[model samples]
Every structure is written in structure tokens, then in C-alpha cells.
Target: MNVIHAENIIAGELNEFEQAIRLLKRLHECKARQYLDSWCKRGEAGVYHNVMRKLDRMGNIYQPYADHETEITDWFPLVDCIADTAVYNLKWLGRMGQWHPEALASLTAYVCEQERLQAKEK
Candidate 1:
């Protein structure tokens, strides 16, 4: 199975889809270029893949869909973990909302990492 890394796919940052598009442009520089390229053509088989293909063709810059905020929340590592739960619970909560719980949690974890990096800042 081909799994896209969160960082590679979205970086778990950039609340704006447009900014996410810009971030994608820099992914080519990642060490996993070959791995990513292998699946670029396979996106046609699925909706997500198709969107990815569209993004790829659009050159790493795209505006979010009008419903992006209501659909996909900011991705974070922790939130990513529980995102599915949050998404599922939305209906139970009687509110059609997008809450990336795991992603948010992961983002917090990432923040901790960033703090560590900052400690070594020169």
C-alpha cells in the first residue's frame, strides 16, 4: 500500500488551503521525491488521488474550496490521530463540523519539537 506522509501531503500547518498549495511546491525538494513520484499517476483512481493530481498540475498553488474550513480542519499530528473519531462524532454531536482532533494533538507534539529546535537556535 502506498501511504503519503502527512508532512509530504499537508505538513500539518497552513490553515489556508492556498498556503498548503504553496507548501506542496517545496515538497519536490524532499528526500522522498522518488517515492512520491511513483504514485502521482495513480491519483486518477480515487477522489483524493484525483485532487492530488489536480494540485500537482496546478503547480503547488491553489485556493481552498469554499467549504474547506467546514470540511477539512488544520492537520496536526495529534489531531491526525483522532481526526477520524472527531469526524465521526460530528454527526453524533448534531453538528456537521470538521474537527481534526488528532491533527491538533499532533500539531501540539510538533510544537514541542519546534521548541526543542528553537532551543538550539543560533
Candidate 2:
């Protein structure tokens, strides 16, 4: 009976730990999205006939999708640009060096370690 009670305590702790991990990951995901959105905002140009021509020099800066935004008047055109930007930023961030699983694992480990350290502080 004592062993069973201990096991249940462990299981409950694990569940709580898992929930904390998920919440941290969700917040990180939201932060990453906001980062991408900020980058995308830089692409948005006013509707002008010479906008693309003027923004042509922006290609030298190696941004995510400035070219797409030069002419984007609606949401449909942005889909491909955002996808490309995500891939570009992922590569730029060194995430391409490791696959998705490894990236996720590293993020998870970082979050877990931070949580552990933070809990120790309080």
C-alpha cells in the first residue's frame, strides 16, 4: 500500500511536470510566431506602382519575404511568402542543422532546465 501511494504521487508529479512543459512550449511558440509576424510586417509596402521596383534593393539584405510584400494586396499572396520566410528564418536560426525532432528536444530540455532552476529559486 505504501508503494502504491508513492507511485501515485510520482504519477501526479509527472502529470504536473508535463503540463508545465506544455505551457512553456506554447508560450515559446507564441513568441516565435510574434517574431515571424514582426519580420513579415517589414515586408508590407504601400500600394504604389513603383513599390516593387523601389524595394528591389532589399534583396541584398537577405530578408525572409520582402519581395512578396512589395506587391501583396491581400492574404492569398502572403501564404507562400510566410512559408518561405519560416524556412529561411529556420535555416538562419540554425534549426535546419538539426531536424524538427532535435530542435523540439533541445527546446524542451531548455524549458525543463529553466523551470527547474526557477522553481529552485522560489
Query: Best candidate, lDDT-wise?
Result: 2
TM-score winner: 2
Q: What TM-score would every model get versus the actual structure?
A: 0.21, 0.24
Instruction: Provide the overall lDDT of each model, using Cα atoms, as 2-decimal numbers.
Output: 0.42, 0.46
Per-residue accuracy of model 1 over 9-105 as CA lDDT, tens digit each? 5544445554433444444345235454443244324434544444454332223434353443454533333332332232222221223466556
Residue-wise C-alpha lDDT for candidate 2, range 28-88, written one tens digit per residue: 4766676654433333232121234334433433344465545435543343343344433
After superposition on all C-alphas, the RMSD of every candidate to the true structure, in Å, is: 18.9, 17.3
Residue 122's lDDT within candidate 1 is: 53
In angstroms, give how far residue 39 of model 1 lies from its true place: 0.7
